[model samples]
Every structure is written in structure tokens, then in C-alpha cells.
Target: MTKVQFRTAEERDRAQWADKFTAVAEGNLYRDKNSPFPIHEYFKLGLLGKEVRMLELNAGAALVDHMVADALTELNISSETEGNADEIKDWHKSIFYQDTLEQTARSFFSCGYAAQQVVRDIDPDTNENTYTIITLNSKTWYPTVPTFKYQEIREGRVVSIFSENNDGVKSWYAFVERHTKGNVEHELYKLENGNDLEGTKLKIKDLDRFKELEDSVATDLNHIPIFQIDMTRGAGKYFGQSIFAKIWGNLQEISEIKTQMRMERIKHFRSLLAAPAQSLQRAQRVDDGEALPNNSKQARVEQYEHQATFDLRQEIMAVPPGAQMPQFIQRDLEIITKAMEMIRDCLSEIASVTGCPRSVFNLDEKGTIHVETEKKKDRKYVQRITQCQKKLEWITEQGAKTYFQWKGDKAGKKEITAELDSAFEMTLEEKVDLYRKMNSDGKFISQEEAVRNLFPDMTEEERTEMLQKIQDEDKSLAGSFGDPVPVEL
Candidate 1:
């Protein structure tokens, strides 16, 4: 098979999807600004109620991840006899679960897309099959060709690349080097000026060395292992459209509403802090009265201002006779209260648009969803989880096949399995009740089957032991003349 020049495609695809990528990046920024990380340090003080370093509300971003995480229940995988069901199940429990695929799915939901690639290899010393899973963030994934289907990326000649500086190191190193020479530490050192070697001035000869060093980093960066791009694309028109993307307008509206509310609050505080409008009693002038002591009206007004500061509730000014008092104006707090109402409405709307229940947003609405209505919501999200399962199924199958091939299995047969029963909805009590109903009137459900349904986390050995105990008890009871008491189903 001819090798595809993936490097060329990476450059081409990055440019092709430049606009969309920009939008995703900006959307992520806006999300962080509105929810967790404040767009500015000062903004945090204004919105979050305190001034601190590196603070943001970040609710908008977290809302997306939380909704997805809460909805995901469990993943069950199994395969045919050729697939080594026991080993596959063990792998699912140990390796797959260790990868925290559900958390990765949360990322996919948050970022509009996420990717996983399967790699197969052998342990040379032990001659045992091994697998490697590569998870990619949205930023690193670029499709060279346009493909609507997530699993059909290979046909589109896609390439996923992750790049980072090595702190002047030449080659790529795994695990330990990740901490000593990886991007994070390097950035920290740069920020702290640790990279500045004192008294080490660069000479002309160093230019060549610097250039060589850069070239070496570039060479190491280009060596990306290509993989098939599989995303849990659930009802999204395109891979770039994240759960947050569709409801971005609403999130933005909520963000704006929050900002406005904060301003209104500030306004209210200022009004409270300020002195209240006072009723002034103007002085009346009598032409026949003794001549005033060269006192001007302006002098009289200043005297009244000085007296008022010392606890004068009302200002009494000496004015010409027949002076009319100005109409009293009251502070109208209703506008601020009305703004609060607007904010509540915006929050409810945001929750509605994002498919999140209003309760999640902490709205005060007393409405409750009907049982059937809730089931519909559950079904909608369950379908999303199923779509993600399909992607995982493909990934696991390919990985298994590769593992068998490395072991010289001619057929190279394998299957990746997934089971998301009832969308993670069975309580122990519920399962037990159902089992009792199923076993009533000689309609017996096997102990193993009942255990499997009730406690999926139980191992086969544990289930077997429990089953044996039940069987032994039944035999002991049968030996007596009375009918054997039935074991709990």
C-alpha cells in the first residue's frame, strides 16, 4: 500500500478549516469568560462579587460539560467467542475504564468534537498482544477532505497532529520527559525567567547552533502517528458544532443579562449610599421688615448647606416671600427589580435552549416536568450516548483486530463491545422488585440473569459464587419434607 503524504494534508486542512477553528477557539474563550475564567481580572470583581487573581464565573462553559457528564451512565463491551470474551471484558474493565472515556466524551461535547485512535503492538519480551489508545483534542484534529461521517475520515485522508516545544531538547521522549521537558514546565520557566542564563551572551557561532536546534524540534514535531478520526457525533450537522455552539446565542444573552444585572446592582448600591433628596423650606422676604445685614441669598444658601451636614433632616432657606417649593422626586427602585426579572427570564431561556432543566440553572420556577415529558428528555440524551457508543465500538473493534493480527491469528477476528442498558437507570431496589415480579407464579428468572441486571459491576466469579450458594441452600431445603423455601430471586 502506498503511504499517504499526511504532512501536506495537515497544512492544507488547517487552512481550509481556519474560519471554523477560529470560531471554536473564540467560542471556548467566550465560554470561559462567562463562566469560569473571567475575561478580565476586574470583570471578575464586577460579576463574581470579589476581586482576586485569575478568577472567572465559567458557568457557561461548565454547564455544557456538566450536562454531558451527568447524562452518561456506563459503557458495556463484549464480543463473540473468537474475541476472547473474558479477556475483552477484563480489558474493558481495566484498560478502557482507566482511560476515562466518559470524561473524554465530556470534552467532545464541550468542544464540538473529540477523537480517539487505536494502535496495536506486541510486547517483545513476553510475546503478548498490547493496544494503545490515542485521544485527540479538537484543536489538533484537522480533516484534509470534507467528510460528514466521523468514521469515514480515512477515506478523506485526515491527519491528527499534536505539537509542543522540548525546552531545547532534540528528540521526543515519553512519560518522565513529559514533566521535565514538556510544554507546561517550559512555559513556567519562561514566565519566571528561569530560561535566562546570566552572563551567557550569544556569539555569532551560536546562531548556527540555534538554527540547528530549531530544526531538530521541527523534525521531532512532524513524526505524528496517523490514526482514524472517530468522534461521538450526536445529531450535530457537522463535527465542529459543539453542544455549546448551538445554544451560544442564548449563553451570550445570559452573559449580557448577568452583566446588566451587576450594573444595576451597583447602581442600586450607589443610590442607597447617597444622601436622600430633602424637602427645602424657602425663606419669605418682608419689605417692611428690618433691612437684612447685607446678606445675599447665595450667602444664606451656603449657611443652610453647612447646617444641613450636621443632621438637618430638612433644609429651611430664607428666600423672598411667596417662593414656591420644588416638587419632590423619589428614587424609583422598581426599575432595578424589573431588571432582576429580566435576568430570571434569560436564565430560563438559556436552560431551555441548551436542553438543560431549569432547575440546573437554579431558576425559581415551580413547574415540574411530567413523567412522560422527562422520559422524552431522557430518550433524547440516551440517543446521544448511543451515538458515542457506536464510535467507541468501532475504535475497540479495530484495536482488537490489530491485536490478533500481531499475534499471527490468520483470521484476525475481534469485536469491541458496548452496553448502555436503560441509559444507566436501574436502581438496586428497582432491579430486585422487577426480579421478584418476573419470578412470581413459576415465571422464574435465573439468579445469574437477575444478578447481572442488578449489579453490573459484580465480577463473573462473584456472581458464580452467589449462584452456588443459592443452589446449595435449595438442595438443603429439598431434603426436608416441607416444600423448600424459595431463595430470594
Candidate 2:
């Protein structure tokens, strides 16, 4: 790789490669439903696998990885002008080539699985031309390299690198050289010696290693080989066959069988997976009325209490000398000093506010105030009457003495007229007759005053005649408040 420029075009190529390769691996490996190859990588990237967090490798996946590496190399070269390009490469060399990043990376390695194929023409039973390549992928969410593998820079070389897990525990893995021919059978055995070395051993078989390769590939795993990738690829003219990324969740019913899992397996999975823990004690506080607990908890917590202090003691000459209080006691002291202080300040302020000299009984929290005013509360008699319905049997001359009471000298001839000529439809003659009924006892002085105010002075005969005329007019004006009813003796 040479110095290259960082470009969007390069990024697109890299992402596309990751997608295409994953799809190719899935389509090829998952030809049949029962195939053990999990299309995890394919599902994740190209959307070709049926299970979650799984990978199915194929020509496409291999190609995607290969091309992505190629692209990265191109990018680093292009970005030569970037800050410390050569310097960065030098640092990487010091780590990777010098076995610095190996320890941590190895802990997360998990294992390495390989499948070998003969690249030459040969007899099915006895062929002697073959080569083996180990494939590597990550189980962690770490995104350093897409994948890695051990390969000999020369022919006739078999290299196996072994190391214990990060915890420095577990039985040493037994890696033995495998040989194979078609229907090849390799011994599933272990290495007697647990050892460590600066390098590894490599076995190169030119004549044939068929049986060995086949047996090794079928180790532990019941299903065919499937490698998961990041994503899928779209259609291109001279590119890969139209590979569809399988959505893993869609075929979840099938994958469920592979995992042998049910909803019960995730009984509290959704809730547990969605959130973090909280602490109950964090909501508590101290005697100062302050809130306690400043954190969250995943479980319940027990609570406690703190009490106030109070005590009473006296110098008892009759008691024994050795028996005594903690010596920190302040006997007969006011336990509620803060409250008492507050009350004292309030009283002092009130004393200055009112010229009453002392305010020992001011309106404090413990005291009461009965405010008295000199003036009486006035009363109003105006009442609203709704639209008149039937009769409102008010005092009439006949029923006057029965219901009405006089609050003055001898009662005057009172007229109780119906609110007429509007809502209830009354005529002036009815009103005059009604008034006369309420004043049956002549009451000349009062009738004279009524007739004068509403009508005007007139002789007894004239008054009768005028009153009749006005009543007739009120009948015409019945819809209006009847022409002011004429008063009479």
C-alpha cells in the first residue's frame, strides 16, 4: 500500500465490501434450513442471517474483509498527509509485530476454526495436492479488525499459536496436526504436553491431508460453517449476484429452535435489559430535615430513624455519689430552643408595632386573635323576581288585614297591584278593582292621596268616570305596563 488521500469514495467502497461479503457467505452456507452455519454476520450487515448476533461466512464475507483491509491500506496511504501517518504506522508495528497488542487481543480471541480445500485436480480417493487456511472473527463488540487468521508466508508450514485465557486459568488447548483425503478422517486427540513458545509449529502436506481437514472442521459444531457479517450489498452490473440480506428477526421462529429458547428464557429480559438499578435509601434525610441517599439501587433497602434529645436531672444529696448523668446533660433545658427563639423575636417585633407596651398574648402560632370592628354590616332588600307566572297572592283589602302588619300609625289603605300588562297579561280595570278590594274601609284620606299621585284631584263622580275611562285604555295597552292604574276612594 502507498500513501493515499482520505476520501468519501474510499469509505463507500469499504462499507459496501463488508455488506456484499456477508451476503455471499449467508447465501452459500445457508443453502438448506438444517445447515449449522449461523448467518449472524450476514444478518447483521447484509441482512442475510436469521439469528441475532451471529455470522455466516462465504466468498462474499471473505471478499468484504479482504477488500476492506485493502481499502484501509489505501486510506492510510492516501492519508499520508494526515497527522503522523508514518509515525502512527511505526507505533502500530512496534505493538502488533512486536507482540504488544497480542495479549489483550488473545484473551478475547475465544478460538480459531478452519476448513481446508484442495485447489488442484485429483482422484477423490487418493489426492495429494492441498493447503489449509485458518479463519478468525471476534466475539466482542470491539471493532478493531473485521477478522484475522494465521497464515504461513511460505509453503510446507503449519503454524499454531496457543495462549491461556486472560484470567491465566483453564486447561491448555491441545492442537495436533491434521491430515486428510476426501471423506478424510482425522483423530480427535489431545497434545500430552502443556507448553509455551516464542513461535508455533506448522505442518505442510503436499500429497494429501483430506481426512485431517474434514475431521477438524467438524469439531464440536453440529451445524455447517456460517460466519456473520455487518451488512448486505445492493445490485451492481459487473458485481456479485443479487444477494438479499436476511432479516434475522423475521426467521426468529426458526432461530428459536436453533437456540432452544422460549419467552420464559427472557422472563424479565425486557425490563432488566432496558434499565439500570436505583437505591431506595437515597431518598432519606437527617434530623435537619435534609434529604438522604444521592444514588440509585437495583433492590429494596431498610430504613432507620433518629430522635430528638431531652432529659431532666437534679442535685440529689439523698442519692449515691457514684450514680450520675453522662456529664454532657443540660437538665431542665428547653429542648425546642429554636422554636422558643422564633417566638421571642415575633413578640419583640409586635411590641414595637403596637403602642400597647407589652404583647405577651400577640397572634403567635400558639396565640389567637379575635378582630372586632365598630361598624355594623349593612343589609340590602332588593330582590330579583323572574317572569311572572300565576298569581302572587299579595295583601289585598280582603286578605290585607290577614297577612300584612303595619310598622307605623293606623294602617293606610294599601294597594297590592299585580305586575300586569306584561308577562301575566292584566288590564288596568283589574288592577283598580284589586286595589279597591285591599282598601275596603273607604280610608278617604289615603285614597285621596293615591288618586292624586297616580291620576289627580277629581270629584267623587268624576273620579269614577275618569277611572273607568283609563281602565278601558289600559286594556288596549295590556301588552305594555297597563296605563298607570288610577287610584280611587
Instruction: Indicate which candidate wins on lDDT.
Output: 1
Q: Give one digit per residue, the lDDT tens place, for model 2 in 145-217.
A: 2222222111111223233443775433223323222221222212222332211222222114323343333
| Model 1 / residue 424 / CA error / Å | 6.3
Q: What local lDDT score does residue 473 receive in model 2, on the 0 to 100 scale?
A: 84
lDDT for model 2 comes to: 0.28
lDDT (CA) per prediction: 0.47, 0.28
- Over 1-489, each residue of candidate 1 has an lDDT whose tens digit, in order, gives 222122343444433343233333334433332232225545545654554223123346556554555545555557656547666666556565536466456555666566554444457799975666556544444444435544343312222222245687432111100111111110011111211111222221333222322211111111123333233345644454456555655555555556665565556565422233343433443332555445899667666764554332445533345555444344566776776576566666666665665655554344333232232233334445545544444555555554444445545455545444544455577557656665566333456666776777888899888889989898877777476658997
Model 1 off-target regions past 4 Å? 1-63, 92-99, 119-130, 146-151, 155-240, 266-340, 351-379, 403-410, 424-489
Once model 1 is optimally superposed onto the true structure by TM-score, how far is the C-alpha of residue 249 displaced, in angstroms?
1.9
TM-score of each: 0.49, 0.14
RMSD of each: 15.2, 46.1
TM-score for predicted model 1 compared with the true structure: 0.49
